[model samples]
Target: MLTIEDCIALSGLNEAEIEAISEHEHIPEIVAVEYGNYLMHSPDGVPMLKRIILDDIAAAEQRNDLKHALHLRLVLRHFIRTHRDLHKVAN
Candidate 1:
């Protein structure tokens, strides 16, 4: 059985992205790992994660939480740089 840490390490997603997904989707960290794995493997996963990050950033903005919004934005930017598909989307 794959541990959450194992999955996270293999998924190539940052901790912030995983934490944001887990919190936004109300899922456990392990589940978030599985979701991250799926997204990492799927062709459309990068776009989906991008959309989720945008939503999280929007929510943070709505709450006037500049720190959280900036953090999420940074995560998204990092994801785009690290993942080729997402980099394409960023361009």
Candidate 2:
């Protein structure tokens, strides 16, 4: 059987990006992997993913977890950089 790691590997997103989607959507990692894949292909998906990551960053900042907030920023950057074709979604 394929493990969660295997599933994550099949998706375009990295583990951190999958985790952020899980956290934002309140889903498990495996589910997030599938959801993230779906989002990456749809037209409006990039902005939605951006919103999710931004929300995560805001939540981390709200709790004073600057480290996590910074990490999420990196994740956001990578996400944007990875989905270059969809980058014109106009944040």
Candidate 3:
């Protein structure tokens, strides 16, 4: 039985990124983990996750949660730096 943490670790997404995906897709974190795992292997899914994180940052700002918003921004920055090739097309 893989725990949620294990699933998340395997997906290569941080908690904030996974949470963004969950909220955007209106699914639970555990389900998002499975989806994330799939997405991590797909070219389209990388950009999709980026969009989800942007949406989450916007939502946080709308609620006046600057701290959370800033944190999420940092997470996005790190994700982008680490997964730069994920967004590129072979052709």
The pairs that clash in candidate 1 are: none
lDDT of 3 by residue, 1-91 (tens): 9888888999998787888788878999999998988988886888877887899899999999999899889978987877877755511
RMSD to true structure for each model, in Å: 2.2, 1.5, 2.1
Once fitted onto the true fold, the runs of candidate 2 whose alpha carbons sit more than 4 angstroms away are: 89-91
A best-first ranking of the candidates according to their lDDT comes to: 2, 1, 3
Q: What overall lDDT goes with each candidate model?
A: 0.84, 0.91, 0.84
For each of the candidates, give the backbone clash count: 0, 0, 0
**Top-scoring candidate (lDDT):** 2
Clashing pairs for model 3 are none
**What's the CA error at residue 31 for candidate 3, in Å?**
0.6
Q: Against the hidden true structure, what lDDT does model 2 obtain?
A: 0.91
Instruction: Give one digit per residue, the lDDT tens place, for model 2 in 44-67.
Output: 888999999999999999999999
* Candidate 1 lDDT, 1-91, residue by residue in tens: 9776777898888788898888789899888878988987777788888888899999999999999999999988888778875657544
User: Measured by C-alpha RMSD in angstroms, how accurate is candidate 1?
Assistant: 2.2
